[model samples]
Target: MKIVESHKTDVDNYIITHHYLRSAPAGARLRLWVKDNSDNVIGAMMWGRPTARTYDYNRILELTRLYLIDDTEHCAESKALGMARKYIRKHLPEIRGLISYSSTGEGHKGTVYLADGWFAVGVTRAAAWNKQGRKNIDKSQKIRWVRSV
Candidate 1:
């Protein structure tokens, strides 16, 4: 599979339609598509500033979305991640690390991240937007994974 630049609209649509969350992130700094040898779009990814205030947004980015077609070849996610990392290292040199979370509530153990050389740092506490006017959000505890670029 080959990684290609993708438009936000196309990536968002693909994520919304195929991803389990069924929604796109609000601010994606980079979007990408994974195409098979035959040129069919088989996956999409989005990277953006980390949501947590502790992370240095100028140096660290979060993989906010990653969705692949169910029938793709084995290790496709790992390959896509490897390509994306190389792209970021070359094009966004200021970036020093990448992070992503796997939701325990969603039964995700972060196998793809592990396979791509990311390490689990810790688990985040379950919290939510408790403001009176805000809508309820999933406060699932997540495993934080990180990879140095």
Candidate 2:
């Protein structure tokens, strides 16, 4: 698995694949891609936004876009999340904590955020979206989680 601060171009394809890709709006994302021995991007994460237009900034590193394919790297999820936090604390110490949101409908979390010491801040009544034409996410009811870095 390789963790990288996205070079912009390297990530356009994957982000584009998500239907609501704009919600996580990629601006200045720190990314991690887990590649198989054949070097295919199986798991990925987009770590931050350049600006907080929708979600409020809380002096925390916004760890979003945690993605992993089935059994790609076994521990890719945990490793990717760790790299995300470590990278921020090491390189961007100005950020105070780590925060992220997940849908209850997202089924289950696989020890990535849990192992990193992230905890539930509160359950959001509705997940808000900043897009036009459409409202927020249908799975609007999500749980917010946070961890201090």
Best candidate according to lDDT: 1
TM-score of 2: 0.73
lDDT of 1 at 9: 82
**Candidate number achieving the greatest TM-score relative to the actual structure:** 1
User: In candidate 1, how many Å is residue 28 off?
Assistant: 0.4
- What lDDT score goes with residue 138 in model 2? 46
lDDT of 2: 0.62
Model 1 agreement with the true structure over 1-149: per-residue lDDT tens digits: 99998764889898889888777888899999999999999999999999999999999999999999989999999999999999999999999999999999889999999999999999999876553553434568999999998
Q: Give the lowest summed-lDDT range of ten residues in model 1.
A: 129-138
Q: Output the worst ten-in-a-row residue range by lDDT, candidate 2.
A: 19-28
Q: Cα deviation of 106 in candidate 1 (Å)?
A: 1.1
> Per-residue lDDT for 8-107 in model 2, tens only?
5455557546424334455544665655567676756676742335654545557666666676655667666776677778887777777777766655
- Each model's RMSD to truth, in Å? 2.0, 3.7
What is the Cα-based lDDT of residue 23 in candidate 1?
A: 76
- Candidate 2 Cα outliers beyond 4 Å, as residue runs: 18-24, 36-39, 49-58, 109-111, 127-130, 135-138
> Please, what is the whole-model Cα lDDT of each candidate in the order they appear?
0.90, 0.62
